[model samples]
Target: MNRVPVSSSNLSSVGYDESNQVLEIEFHGGRVYQYFDVPQRIHQELMNAGSHGKYFHRNIEDKYRYDQVK
Candidate 1:
């Protein structure tokens, strides 16, 4: 997936696959993760959020199945 860089304390970038409902997040430390069964609205909200990390924690984390990509 192609990811776009974002301004965040812990996150470096984010990407989404609408067809597959997968959300990929890359952290500053170089760790990347893909969250499954995600909604497009959530991905859009994350991109528009003031704090990506906060929004992820509040709405996404522990809410979907995920896998580490890097």
Candidate 2:
């Protein structure tokens, strides 16, 4: 499977599946989540932040993590 690099402003860690275009995120407080079919708008939002790392830390870290999608 191909994998893409995803960075989120609200995430401490990021994972991706290029074949499926899925993105997985890990937050600060043991939160994990998977975002599927991520729209370009959201992708841009994640990438274009001035403080991308900080945005992720403030918004998602410790909040959620990636879960398998049906």
Candidate 3:
């Protein structure tokens, strides 16, 4: 199980569980997403985005490598 670090910046709020390779993201609109099979580098890129919150929603959430929260 990989152990990815979680960023604490207010620009983004996301959690990753290495055991299952699941990524949990909380967007600015209060929308959430759980991404599966996400690579560590991609996760870091997502967190490092200038607009982390918005990028997650616009690019990743329900589009790229992630699905909407159940």
Candidate 4:
């Protein structure tokens, strides 16, 4: 997966592996996490949202299985 930097106070960057359905997120304080079993639609919405942090909290946080990568 290729991570792309985003404009968000609560997020640093984001990445998605479509074949595996995994969504990777890097937070402001150097925390990294991979959320599994995420749909591509959700990923796209997150990317296009006005507030990445808000979109994540409302749609993704605690909604899928995840693992801390850093």
Task: Write down the TM-score of every candidate.
Answer: 0.97, 0.47, 0.55, 0.97
Alpha carbon lDDT at 15, candidate 2: 59
The model with the greatest lDDT is 4
- Badly placed stretches (over 4 Å) of model 1 are none
Model 1 Cα shift for residue 68 (angstroms): 0.5
Give me the overall lDDT of model 1: 0.96
Ranking by lDDT: 4, 1, 3, 2
Worst 10 residues of 4 by lDDT: 1-10
Error of 2 at 62 (Å): 17
Clashing residue pair totals per candidate (backbone < 3 A): 0, 15, 0, 0
Report how far off residue 66 is in candidate 3 (Å).
5.1
Name the lDDT of candidate 3: 0.63
- Judged by TM-score, which candidate is best? 4
**Model 1 lDDT, residue 67, Cα:** 98
Candidate 1 C-alpha lDDT tens digits along 1-70: 9999999998999999999999999999999999999999999999999999999999999999999989
Give me the overall lDDT of model 4: 0.97
In candidate 4, how many Å is residue 56 off?
0.2
Q: State the lDDT of candidate 4 residue by residue for 1-70, as single tens digits.
A: 6799999999999999999999999999999999999999999999999999999999999999999989
Better candidate by lDDT, 1 or 4: 4
Give a tens-digit lDDT track for model 3, residues 1-70: 2233335343336777766667787645556667888766667777687766565656656654667773
